[model samples]
Target: MTTAKNDINKRIQELTKALETKSARLNDISNTVIDETGKGHMVISTEAHADYQKTLGEAREIKSLIEEQKAHLDIERFPRRAERAQLCGPGRRPDRARQAVQVPV
Candidate 1:
């Protein structure tokens, strides 16, 4: 369980870093300007705009992956009570003292 938790955390970190890089690239692309000769106005090219959109999409995907990793980490850190009970087997309780009680007839 510890190893699994560690792996999930590592994956989340990796995804977060990737998202950051993609965001940075998107910002750079958005700020890019194309110089059109004889026209004093700075404008972005179609290709640069497309690149920004693609990077933005990638960043969104990475953000989703990070969220999934966080969910996995949460599960690993705090397993559901029902799952723990299941591990005790059928007709068995988690508390041994409760299991030792005798029913009065």
Candidate 2:
């Protein structure tokens, strides 16, 4: 579990860094001036805009992947009640863990 969690974290970090780089590049492209037809007209980088869109899509995918990893971790951390009882409820018998505890009443 720890290994899997660490792997997921590492992937998330890499994806985040890649996304940041793409965003910065997109911003730079957006700021660039492509062609100056006249004082009233100017064109920015079309290729940059396209790259930005692609990057944005990739970022969204990364975000979703991160969320999925987190959800999986949570599920692992907190299992079903019966499963828990089976693991630590009774004397050595895990199958009998779900049985109700006896009382004097």
Whose lDDT is greatest here? Answer: 1
Q: What stretches of model 2 exceed 4 Å from their correct place?
A: 33-42, 80-105
lDDT of 1 at 95: 70
How well does each candidate superpose onto the true structure, as a TM-score?
A: 0.64, 0.51
- Give the per-residue lDDT of model 1 (tens digit) for 1-105: 577878888888888889889988987996787666758677888899889888888898999888888877776767655665666666777676345455577
Task: Give the TM-score comparing model 2 with the true structure, all chains together.
Answer: 0.51
What RMSD does each model have against the real structure? 7.1, 7.6
Could you tell me how far off, in angstroms, the CA of residue 1 lies in candidate 1 after the best superposition? 6.8
How far out, in Å, is residue 16 in model 1? 1.1
Across 15-56, the per-residue lDDT of candidate 2 in tens digits comes to 678767766766776677555876758675677667767767
lDDT of each: 0.78, 0.68
Number of clashes found in candidate 2: 0
Error of 2 at 64 (Å): 2.1
Poorest 10 consecutive residues by lDDT, candidate 1: 94-103
